[model samples]
Target: MKKLFSCILCLSLMVCIPVYAQDVDYSDEDYWYATCSKVQTSQEGVKACVGFQNYLDDQFNKLKEEMESYKNDLGSLQLNSSRIEELAKKQKTLSDSLDSQVKNMENQIVEINKEIEAVKVEIEEKQKEIDKWSDQISTRMINEQAGTGTNILIDLIMGSSSLNEMFRRFSGIERITASDQEQIEQLSDLKKELELKKDEQERLSDQIEEQKERIEEEKAFAQELQASYDQLAEEYRKVEADLKQKLQEQAAASNNIPSAGVISPSVEVTVPSVSGFINPVPGAYRSAGTWAYPGGGMHLGEDMAASIGTPVIAPADGVIIYASNPAPTNGGYLGNWTGWPYGGGNTIEMLCNVNGTLYAISFAHLAQEGFGVSAGQVVSQGQYLAAVGNSGNSSGAHCHIEVINLGSMSMETAISRFAASADFAFGAGWNTTATACEAGASAPCRERPERFF
Candidate 1:
């Protein structure tokens, strides 16, 4: 019986040992078993529970940190239109990585469930042992002649051959009861530990589930971006084409020379006292006639051909409508300062009214300092706006003067008219918008049927 009890105790301890990587011990019973523990169910249960709990803690912290980093990256990506493709690619990679991690966590959870089942079986065996011992105690009580402490004393008196034998019987019953009590205490501790572990496992399971859902959400978002990428590329292509076309037309118009004797009625009338505004550049080589006349391409406006320090002059009394460096490849007379194929390196536009018609007179190919005029300042004709420099499509130092009507024409139309009209000196000096340029006066004035392209 002594050997049998010892074997039972050893087997119980062994039951809780972990099959996984670590050991778990939530109570004194677990430590006690570990000390006397054999390879059995109770020992394995304790170890597995502790191991699973540790795994849960480690994984939860790792995933939480990763989620925070991903959110921050996404926030930055949202602000930049140029980084859209790169952002999508990175998001996809993160989603895939998260999926793999979630799978690993879930597999760990499955192992935890199996460990719990093994613990349950061990607990059931312990309960059976408690019941068997309880029955043995009940039988000993009933079979004995004594029923109470007084009855036990009288029975000992009648049955004893000597006082020592009576005392020994009493001591044996005490020992049995003590052993039962110890077993009950140990079983109770194990049961409490098992309940705690089960709760922890449930909590971790829920977290893993939530993470899986989040991974799925991110994956869906990545797919959505992939689906839209092609469409965005096509739209970008269209925008690029439109911008290139406008730039080319602008360049051509700036270089054109108008045809003579082909006067359009729209530009026929000249404003009074216009001659006062014609300030010539000093040392400029003047063409004898308007650009329309033969051999007259010798620079429409004063080609100051000035050095970097030469002061730029505003051609008329006007408010500064635009005063800044030109964008790269903006092209044409306005875009000259920026240099080109597409020109208009650094430039400015000033709005002046002649006989109630608004005109935007622009200057290009200016020194850097010249591009910094205050918009809306009233500038006198020939007042310094900036310095001249060799900064544009020109072969040498020069400034390009171009006139425009700010009458709500689309930029493309304005460019076309300016180019086509440059051939006829003063042909670009229209009182109306470019849309009305070739319309020849009609209701709801339409563009000329001919398309420049």
Candidate 2:
């Protein structure tokens, strides 16, 4: 029993100490879950945690590579939604993968703990047998064929001081029954098994800790992207509002000429049934601004309010110039324009020909995932483009529609340079600060929907 205990101690010591790698593994699962960065929590007495910057950087880069692959697949800046779906999938995978792997690790840990306890109990029962037949186990071990000399037990016989002592030791070996020898061998097996369980537990615990860090960092970078996206949206809202004010002035010169206290709609009483251009939001009514707001804010687009899922169709045959579909349909506030094209939210812009001239028709505050068309896709007049949503700096559910006539630019050149810069204003001179779109200005002027729709 003393020898058995000695061997077990040696095995435990081997598990407890290693020559290299000062890192330690978790003994409890809570230790891994409760902490994200031990290095960051150094002053609070935490250890075995990951380094904040290096570990996070590695994970951030890996996920960025995965997201960038989707972006590259999309092939153009007009397809800003390319990375959003991939980011969502990656986030979901991170969650599911961590849950499954951690559950597996937990099950392994529980079984290993049970294994360790069982081994301890087995050793205890063996120790009890030693107490039951103390005299027999106290006798020296021996090799049945001393001449074969396989085991260290022969040392006892060879190291005897005298002929009488050697025979006496042989007699001692006779008292060591087969049962006692079997118990020693069983204990040896138990020691090896225990060491393996310990090592495996240590390894699994380390993997779980590393996995926790990786997942945490990935989520951190995603949140960082959200913050940056929101900040950019806020900044662009200022510019969008400013440019819109300037565009409003272009039409204000003609519009300011006459208005009773009540601004009247001049929509043609004779609605054409089989015309080239049609009303984009067919079932919706103007809720607020039309050409210009009632109080005359720089309303560049007409606001057509409708139910949340109201379909907004293309007014004429057109090619989709740009589209973004990342924001939530009902997640808009007064100043929240958080997506591509800055403050436009989930927007879609198409280049169409109306009245023998190219027109860039923009539909803003569109539904997020509810859009049926993608950027660069072609559609006929009255085709389903997207559903209306209260996104961006909007207060209610509606679609803000803007139309700019592109003079004589070819379809290829016009589509290529639609959103060339922040000052794009849908097309070329639509909002050029110097170009006044007063009553009779050229083709690049803002066209009124009430006058033509």
Candidate 3:
């Protein structure tokens, strides 16, 4: 009866051990379990348990420090993101203004061309009048030199019936001379006016040409700015992707425990309950799963089309794992300085628990400085997250959402799988590539977001 009681006591003690401790190696009977068993109820056994607890505490503390460092980095990234959004908007505005100016200049040039044509016609008409007057003057001079004018004058005087008639003829000749002189003077004045008009036309033409050149220069500058914006956006995406990967690594690190040994008995663990997902965007939303590449690569996330500044909400209760501007850092690959995230734009990634499963939810292409949450922050379902925006590689204002099953695969793999199997509602026949996950590259495995929404 005493032996049986002792055995029962040992069995009860084993059951009391923590599930985490069951994996610890006690096979070397002479070391851990052997000493503990020798004085199972003594101070030495208590000391051993206390030592293990201390080790676990130390490990937890180290993980806490690492988490804090990651949080700080996330904060810095968010600040950068904010600045990038500002710079992007400024650059876009400048580009648009330049475009408008160019268009206005083009219209002015067209009008100037019309004016030049009209001036040319005026000058031609004046030249024709001048030519006609000069011809008349030359004919008169020739007639006078050839004695025709003298003969006419003598005949008129000799054949006159009275002095009054002769005086009338003389008056007629004087009037004719006066008219010719007036015509010559008018022609000369017209030539001067024509010359002035030509000069004015020349000036206008020069002005138009100057304006054209200026517009071209402005366009070139705008293009440069756009290119810079694109590069910065790429850089921002790369950095953001790197940060997400880091976060994943940090999570994996937190879960990784040193294998101590094996336990003969299995333990049942209970998982906490999770909530269902809700629509991330309120009101009217539209999507066609047309996440194709014009910006670069495949569209892994479904775009929820909405007006700019439309409110974005959390799909479920979760902690924000990643949030940042994802703006480029190289001043947009140009000598000019500007910044903004291009592809995903302002992004927020949350790790949600849905029906006891972990899901990584991403919100992309948000408005300028529109994020309402940050990394490590807890958010409730239907909570405001951001506003729809046309930032990044977007063609219009929309919110891009990607749901990744953390339990099944990486986000990238999940995306590829969904793309392969999902029905295309739009952008069909477009090429889709998973370069991010291919060739051993790390990326989030994305699932069909429509399934959850």
Candidate 4:
């Protein structure tokens, strides 16, 4: 019976030892790596792979969120820059206006001084005439008192030789008195005119001084605004530098992950009615559906598969706001490619207004040195814009187009409307909705090329 008990205990010990050997701490990095490495192409291996992918995806999402934050910061900085430019323009206008006003005031002051001087000279001449008349009257009064204590008119009439001569003498005496009276009245008018002119000059001077003070105030305010803008610009530069540093660090971290290339393509597509817009591409082309990329992010535009050297045209009348050769770098693949950092190669962003609504159209992945128009150039509907080619992160020759509503609609809504329009023109299956979007389960801001073609 003792030997039987011993055999049972030995069997129990063997079972317990195997269970202990099978136990694994999955949270440990070393253990996880070891287990995953040994996994073959089986159910267990697939599960392990999925788990690892999920972990990497989580990290990628975090980094993406950080990058988005930085992008928002950069957008704010751009807005600030625009504000500063607007303020500067306003300041220039104000300065010009003030300068013109100052010049006019100075001219008016000069004219007023000339008028005042003329009035002063006229007043001096009138005073001299008054003194001369007074002296004449005083000498006549003294002669009359010394000769006879009688009226000068009576004396003149009595001294006449005949009746006709007396009448003539009386007329002459009356004319002299009338002349002195006229001179006295003219002097009085001149004094009154001088006082009025001096008052006008004083008022004009006051107005000029007031205008100068206002201009100074306005100039000071403009200087203050400029200083504020400068400070804000400095602060924005510092923030931008910090954000760039953080982005570089996050990019380095993402590079360290091994499963960075495994991404799924699943999204929703829509169809709607066509409107006033026409197609941009005139020839044969295929729409590479939204979210068709394996990078697990919104394409933010529809890719049109076409042969190299295919002519790209403008869908509507618009002005080119941005046209440039993109930098030769692929941010996603970490390789030096001949294109933009975001893999769009040569790019153009145009602004078009339709039915009182502003829209921005972005064209990307054009052939190198194939741009037909430049920035600030206006192109009509169906005008040649560029040529299709495999530039940037393109797998083949294609044109990427993005339609952004510059109105009140959100990015998602604009994309949805664009997708519907494309579907109406090109039939269904042009766009789709997906869970693995930048907004996390929300619709992406990319539509099919048929919407604008």
Candidate 5:
């Protein structure tokens, strides 16, 4: 369970899927290839090259900013011990951002691969042309040194009998000599041009290779940061209440928080209810684990992943305890913590009675202005709640649902308790020891929603 929780926390990195790799015309491979291959050639190609390099520079600059931000985040938390989990989350977010930049660089390498290969072929052809020109020049020089053309000219001049014929022969010989010299000059110029192209190709290819190596190094660094973070923290070390407070603080720091009790328009959708509870997201199949498996991640709730605007409904008969829309539906980004409890965008906290047992259920990352019900509202099983949103700390559109067993706790008691202290997941989620609900345990126990679903 600890390992699973770790994996879940890592998902926080993926929450803000992309801080956009800019979409510019210059990002094309031809432009990237021209950036180097035409260094000594056309002005237009040089411009294109500059644009491509500038694109790369911009991405790298963004990465640098993220790194700086990470440093600042760490510095702020250095004096605080209770906020280690938050610090760890910040570290992971920055690490993921860095890793994402590295991938962008690698993608550039891939995009320019064809162009680079074509340049290599051009270099080889230029070298061949240079070789041919050199061979022609060498032959001409050797002939001149041996007086081969000079003897021909002399023979032609001496063999002429009539003065008119002799003049004609001299004219022909002069013409032939001038033509040979002109050919050599032209070939020499061509050879220099080919050599320039070859040099440019070599230079640019080397630069590209260096860029690739640097990206690999950056990738390694991101991995190292992830490893260090994993050791420093294990998902959530603090209690749910503390974590909730931290999220609230983070939102407050922004100063642009969405006010609570913001009612949304009514939504019409069918919800699938089986016995006491219904699928919160009718068509979306929910993940039933604490965190993502196969690789390390951290997730506290069952995620019902779907496209934006997908209807989110109540899992069972419940009363809305607390509801708020704090962030926009499309406002989610990496490292953003705006929301009621840090990334729990447009949250709806409710305590429901499934059969005879009381359970506290929460829905997070809901669409903006899509709240069909509000605080203290009486909602039935499979009632329209909200829509899936790509809200705070979300990688995509999904509703994160958490269910607490609440043992024998009364619905009224659970609601009042939560109202007093906005502790999510019914008192800090699963225990580090046992996953299943302990038999004869006290009321207000956290239960795995997967079992109920």
Candidate 6:
């Protein structure tokens, strides 16, 4: 029995310990070695295991502290939830701004193209006009020169028909020459202006390109930052998982040590369900009184509230043991079913042996028919046994359950000798009805919840 208890406790402890790796201060090398290298045999082994377990816990706590500090730093920098939200808002604003900029740039490009096209058309028209004017001027100059030779140029310029006619012709020629020169100059200036306009359009295009590059850089940087945040979150999760596993393991190891068995005479006992079980009331409650004294400060069996006359079912397969009327001794008024000190009023008990372990299932706050089935009646899991009622000293309608563990001796004697086991299984002021029956005396609690068929 001691060996069995030790093995079960060890397994449970292992399951409870956590395993993690963080920035741990392992400066006490001697302690670590001593804690880790201790062999199992006596109480020293148990102590060493507990010390190691505590060390692991301390390491995890340190890691948690580091993570908290990191979280604070992340807060200082715009990196947490609020920061992400702000960044998202900023990103949206930037996106909208970029969208507007792109549209404006596109519109500008279109307008620039139109302006360039207009300039090209104007340049073409100017070129044609310049060519026509040049041809006309050349023709007039040539004809004049042909008509009046170099020697006649001075005479023709000074004299021609009457004075008024000569003046008019001279002015006409001067006006035409001046007008042609002016046209030529204007056409040259227009061409130079067109070239400058083309240069301005190119510069506008460069600006658009620069804006695009800036947007891309911002997007890439945002992605990198998000990736880093994801990595940090993942690392935190891994560390937490390791820490939990190590804690479970340490707990398992600590509980591996067995209690010294107390010798006692065996009695005719009935065991309960091995695996499948459920709450008879299907709700929560608190115990208001004890068997000895009805009114009590400390709670007894756990109680669960239900509607008046709610059907109470058996949690597991067992034989009806005891079904009794509510006694005045049981405390009636209690808090909500969820609260502590579960109360049981009228009680019905069932006894069954599971994997060599004997257990009793007590149903409290039963209606008029305490046990629907008689004693020695076989019950299946979730079988309706009776309707719940406020028959006992219960404030409301609720069911009280008790799981009694009969050790090698009676509860009365076991408490005096193997108090440790008694305390573990059935201590005072407890509603122990919520018990997970074991397959054997040494089996772990892994009961399937009861279900109505």
Error of 3 at 9 (Å): 99
Model 4: lDDT of residue 377: 67
Q: Using TM-score as the measure, which candidate wins?
A: 5
lDDT of 4 by residue, 256-373 (tens): 2112111111213222212356767667466554444433333445777777678888787776655656532111111113332134567666656555455667776777656688
lDDT of 1 at 197: 49
What are the runs in model 1 whose C-alpha is more than 4 Å off?
1-58, 78-93, 105-126, 141-453
- Candidate 6, residue 36: Cα displacement in angstroms equals 86
Deviation of model 4 at 379, angstroms: 1.1
Candidate with better lDDT, 3 vs 6: 3
Better model by lDDT, 1 or 4? 4
**What lDDT does each candidate get?**
0.45, 0.55, 0.53, 0.48, 0.60, 0.45
Please write out the lDDT profile of model 3 over residues 145-248, one tens digit for every residue.
34323334466767777787676667665655565666655655665566556655665576666667767776766666666666545434433443433433
Evaluated against the true structure, the overall lDDT of model 2 is: 0.55
How many clashes show up per model?
35, 0, 15, 7, 14, 46
Query: What is the TM-score of each predicted model, taking all chains together?
Result: 0.29, 0.40, 0.34, 0.31, 0.50, 0.27
**lDDT at position 228, candidate 1:** 46
> After TM-score superposition, what is the CA distance of residue 380 in candidate 6 from its true location, in Å?
1.5
Model 2 per-residue lDDT tens digits across residues 1-453: 347546654764453332321354443445443443111212222223333223434544666676565345433323133233334334334433444444544554454445445545655665565455433444434333343233336556567667876676565555454446676555555554544444434443564565556556555655554453443333333344555445345434444311211111221111122246888998899865544455433456678889889999988888776777777886665445365444567888777766667777788888886788875677888889999996765555899887776777667666545433322354334323333244666756776555545
Expressed as tens digits, the lDDT of each residue in 1-453 for candidate 6 is 224323533453332222332344445644543333322233333344345545644643554454455445545653243343333333333333334434543454455455545655665675677567556655655565454333233545666767876665666555545655555455455444444434434433453464456445445544544554444333332232233234334534575312222212232323344564566665544333222122222233355567667788877676664444433322233211111111234556565454445455566666765347754456776788887765433444566555654533332243232223312233321322233344343222212222111
Q: Looking at candidate 4, what is the lDDT of residue 328?
A: 27
RMSD of 4: 39.2
Error of 1 at 177 (Å): 7.4
